[model samples]
Target: MSHPVILFEGVGKKFRRSLKADLLYGFQDASRSLFRRKPLEHLRSDEFWALRDISFTAGAGECIGIIGPNGAGKSTLLKLVNGDYRPDRGRIAMRGRIKSLIRLGTGLQPMLTGRENIYIQCAQLGLDKRATDATLDEIVAFAGLEKTLDAPVRHYSDGMYARLEFSIATCLPTDILLVDEVLAVGDIAFQIRCLERLDSLKCNGTTVLFVSHSEMTIRHVADHCLLLFDGEALAFGETDKVFLKYYQSIGYLDRQLKPLGTSPEIPADFAGVASIRALAVKGQENAGGVKVFTGQPVDFEVSYFASVPVDSAGLVLQFWNQADILIATTHSDTDGHRLSLKPDGGRLRLALPFLSLIPGIYRVAGGFVSAGDWLGYGGHLLTLVVAQKQGQAYEGLISIEAKVSNAE
Candidate 1:
């Protein structure tokens, strides 16, 4: 009979905004827990909830993906499961040996050689010398670090280090595997290999907890998903339903575009030389409040007010998908385009010959930098809807022009 390999019941984790307050409150919570008293559920001064009333269960062979924007408690939940942090209130039950690849170079020593580090990591996971010897060659080959295995880990590049870390963590199968944002490492081929390895693990009945910013990857492997927001479990269940809820929360699937009245709250340091007054997109037949079709000539304009005349100012346009993944960026500096801003205000125009994006909603971000300093920046300031073209059925996020010829 199948059973749940991991379970969390009414889990709630709290933290404090100030370091001193965190220490003080942590002691208080510990004392209360020791005395069998209920911890305070309401917010106090200088305190915040990282995870609140989160409950979920993953049965054997089921893979659960955790996702949210930054600081949404995705990593905190994984840490609780890995025993790095304990919940303030609630219980987490695990039924087997757990392996975690939460961060790069976590269980590795800088001075230790790659070969030595592999043995050390395995030993830390309760593997003996016999088991380590059995998997050493395979691990080295999978990481493609044969020449550098004997070299100190400090000498390896980030890609090499990630490869070795991922290889070692997944080399031996365990009952539960926890991976967090480590799949973005290495080259494209290596990432595919890592995904294949995860699929293999799932086939072998390993309960997995996966976390990544890539929605496509998560949707590919996860049997279920959890969407966390503002320290609360906003949605949990099937993969598609949870993903839809997640995107909806971020206004990705909204039929009507939001009013572009004010820009997103920029960081304090990002306000100095210029202010982004407005953002507008113009297509061939559209005046510009959201919907545009593929193959249309789109002109994206950023209107800004300059406090002082600057000659070395540069503008940037970043395009992000519905999943909040930055797919492309265009920079004035990269294209050798120079901007000479006047004192009062000016509009900078970026004209696209043809918008090659497929049928989907995308978020546009605008940024202004002067003298190598970011003067103003705002993300998701404008939304665009790229409708499908009349005669094309493109298969990817964007369309590419290519010619096919036969050699006879």
Candidate 2:
């Protein structure tokens, strides 16, 4: 069998906290090398490991997502892979040519025009004048910077600069690509274009290392994922399992249900009006939360207590992803379904024929509204774990049923 495109064996990288310590260590290491003495293998007093014992491999046409919180060495790992930094320990092997979309405008000269900078970047990528000329129009069109092509890069906005940089970097394909959160730079349309470009490159057998905090984006692109925490590889494997571990690590899955009306979104007038006592999924044994496969039936039974009689109270269920982004909302009033709750309390069941949510963890919050006035709100009342159906793959926040057929 052919070799993997990229491989890492017990890789580690360290850095000093202060410039003084860095300079001192650099001098010491230089002297050790000159004298042929053994270099230090452990962390010094003022130094710490930015990454440690990171071992993984990427075969051709695979995209490995690197995810973690801030200061988790996600960027550091990409820099190492891009040859911008040398590891203090272990080994990294890479085959064929490499290209990176890490720090988009790093090599750009402020005094140079956008048109001139394109040629410079092409040269840096080892493209000759003829080759650069041939692809120049394509790059300019991709960037959508035709009007500003002759303007100095210093006059360009941050978004314009990023567009130019991304266009130039991705104009050509390479064997391995390292992407580090650069997709979030431009506008939404540009970001979509970038993702399409990445997909095209991957289809052409490019091994990719994609680093992003957006789990949805990671899920959409990566076949495997590497999660880092405090410079250590916490978990590395399939995207679903790794994300589950990530949620568990951050206490997202273990979060206890808070009392109704305790959420900050609950209005002051909503106090003592009505509160959701419990939210459970029908037919689920686990009272803690709900777990179901994509396209599976889901029934959310929300038990609530009302202090006063409400003739027409509507129930609203909001679904938010792990990033606290609201993905979907189902309100009873939207479908002409309103509740007639007694003074004491009652149970409200919101049944769904099919749950079309993509595979991931979601926070389910319930609220009551009557006559356009907020009754009460409950935040994080329940957790919804949507898993992929057996032998099925879906992307984005929701899945839609469709039939495929060939044109006659």
What is candidate 2's local distance difference test score?
0.80
Q: How well does each candidate superpose onto the true structure, as a TM-score?
A: 0.62, 0.62
Total colliding residue pairs, candidate 2: 0
Please give the distance, in angstroms, between residue 290's alpha carbon in candidate 1 and its true position after superposition.
Answer: 31
Off by over 4 Å in 1: 255-408
lDDT of 1 by residue, 1-408 (tens): 256899888898877789889888888888998999987756678866688667789988889999878888899998999999988778898999888888787778999999899999989878899999998999999999999999999998888988998898888778999998887867988888998999988888889999988988998889888877656665677787677656654656543433442223334435467767777875322112265656767787777888898777788777766655554567788878878888888887888777776555567776787666687777656766554433334443456655699989
The backbone clash count of each candidate, in order, is 0, 0
Task: State residue 58's C-alpha deviation in candidate 1, in Å.
Answer: 0.3
Q: How well does model 1 score by local distance difference test? A: 0.77
CA RMSD of each candidate after superposition = 15.4, 14.4
lDDT for residue 90 in candidate 1, whole number 0-100:
86
Q: What lDDT score goes with residue 83 in model 2? A: 95
